[model samples]
Target: MLIPTRVRPSELDRLIAAVDPDLRAPLRGRVDLGGTPLSRATLAAARNSIITPRPLPAPPIAARRIAGVPGAPPVSLYVINQGEPGTRRPAILHIHGGGYVLMRADDTFPQLQTIARAHDCVIVTVDYRLAPETRFPGARDDNEAALRWLHREADSLGVDRSRIAVMGESAGGGHAAMLALAARDRGEVSLVAQILVYPMLDDRTGSRRMPRTGIGEIGWTSAQNRFGWGALLGVAAGSSVVPSGAVPARVPDLAGLPPTFIAVGSIDLFVDEDIDYAHRLIDAGVSTDLMVLDGAYHGFDGAVPDAPVTRRFVASRDAALRRAFTPGGWRRG
Candidate 1:
């Protein structure tokens, strides 16, 4: 049996009023996927429409490609530098969210430029391979490779090696978490912090076994969750054999990972998992900060940037990043 989740009355009304009439209907219904060619085309179109570019003016943005591991395709990186030339600055490896199957690094240039300017850091957004084609480990490999490339070229890029951090939203957040874990285990680049925004961290979240109420309605739905996770894992969600590195929530130990910040909406599909992950990170002796905004839905901050709630959310995240990158600012618990 499916339990209906209702959005907070005020939020539902606000969202409905803010969205265009053509999109309002789809927002009310589940994002259906059949894994068929036509359905894939429809999904691509919907994803493109939602992320229609609203370019923001900022410092120069450059596009560059880095060589991947032997036999792998080259990875693209969008470089945004806000600091002066020849001055070393903290760097952020930003991953854009698209439910693991849509969007690109280019789609996030406006937001990335804002973060880079605010923090005065170098921002590199990775254009990783998408799924249902590139599947598990493909995107992960690209993210990890980008991190390695950053470290390898830190001096030339004017990046402060010790102050590097990884940041992402939705599926990208999941990738950031996995990258942090891989970095710890591999004893490679040391990350100062990780910022996850309403991350899609658990495959079991959308399954019937872990149902919740008043979530997954306005932005990303449970059906979309299943599709995204399935595409990445190349298997049905809630499977028994999900690889540890593929799913951050599946990792048994969160010890030795960097200090983390997570923000989510009270009524977002990822609220519970985000909260639980923060709890577990705390339990594992990692410093963690979590922000939950009542009555807000997933992607609310980006969708309704002018709203007070969205402003607060962005402010809190910016403050956290500032603290984390400051010398001796973030301390491990």
Candidate 2:
């Protein structure tokens, strides 16, 4: 399922040399596991093949269901590290990454539980319906429903609604962006921040416009990206007429969104799109922080958590969330 590299040997040599020393072993010799792309025929198998979450002593996690947008089924939520009844804590509505087709709400507890404990905040991860099965607006509706539930039931959940933020890595990150946009437009909930890690943003990145030399050669191939977006979009990924609000990058205006933190590996397929989106957000007067990690590829942090760069990326994300949660640290724009 690996997409054969079209990169020239010299170009590849340069890319290999540029890889962080600790993250280079896979690309240097062994085949990269993340290199596989999914087709309609392989979707089920791809969904079954999952990276076993790195186990940690998880804090208590409660299973809850939130009422969905009218007519849709109830949205499932995993509430992690909920605070005491008399107390209130900042909250994050986390979205799990699976290219918008794979993964579930519970899949992220192993890592998110640690963040919840360390930051002393609650995290509500949503189990949004997958695409090609659910298609445009179905997943969006589920996410919106969960965010609304998180806000409307903040008191019961021991959450400080004003301190709420949305976060995700990869496809989840893209959904977080869309959720933030929806929040701004609907005026029902206010978000303090968005933390996106190497998010899958633009539909045009791998299709329509290919990445510049040596980029996107490591993990999360362009072909897989097309499948992911196409499944969620219900049309050719780069098609001109996507349903409005389906793709965050396709949104015309970025104004009035909350403070944003985006981190992407320089060599990731989403690097160009992520950086471009950050710039567009900034241009729209949104507060933004962007970091491009040199020589890293998509999912680098998850792939090599102990690597110095991965640790640093995780620290940066934690710091951003910490500041966003702090009173007087982030102002609604």
For this target, which candidate reaches the highest lDDT against the unseen true structure? 2
Per-residue lDDT, model 2, residue 52, is: 51
Model 1 CA lDDT for position 295:
71
TM-score of each: 0.87, 0.93
* Cα lDDT of model 2 by residue, 1-333, tens digit: 112244545565676776788887656654333434578888888777675565366678999977899999999988998887757899999998888888887667788999999899999999999988999799989999999999988998899988999999899999999899999999999899999988888887778988787788776778878989999998988998988998899999999999999999888889999999999999999889899999888878766779999888988888889889998775555
* Consecutive 10-residue window with the lowest summed lDDT within model 2: 1-10
Of the candidates shown, which would achieve the greatest TM-score relative to the real structure? 2
Model 2 pairs in collision: none
Instruction: Please identify model 1 stretches exceeding 4 Å from their true place.
Output: 1-41, 48-51, 82-86, 208-210
> For model 2, what is the C-alpha lDDT against the true structure?
0.85
CA lDDT of each candidate? 0.80, 0.85
Candidate 2 vs. true structure, TM-score: 0.93
Scanning candidate 1 in windows of ten residues, the lowest lDDT window is: 30-39
RMSD, every candidate, angstroms: 5.1, 2.5
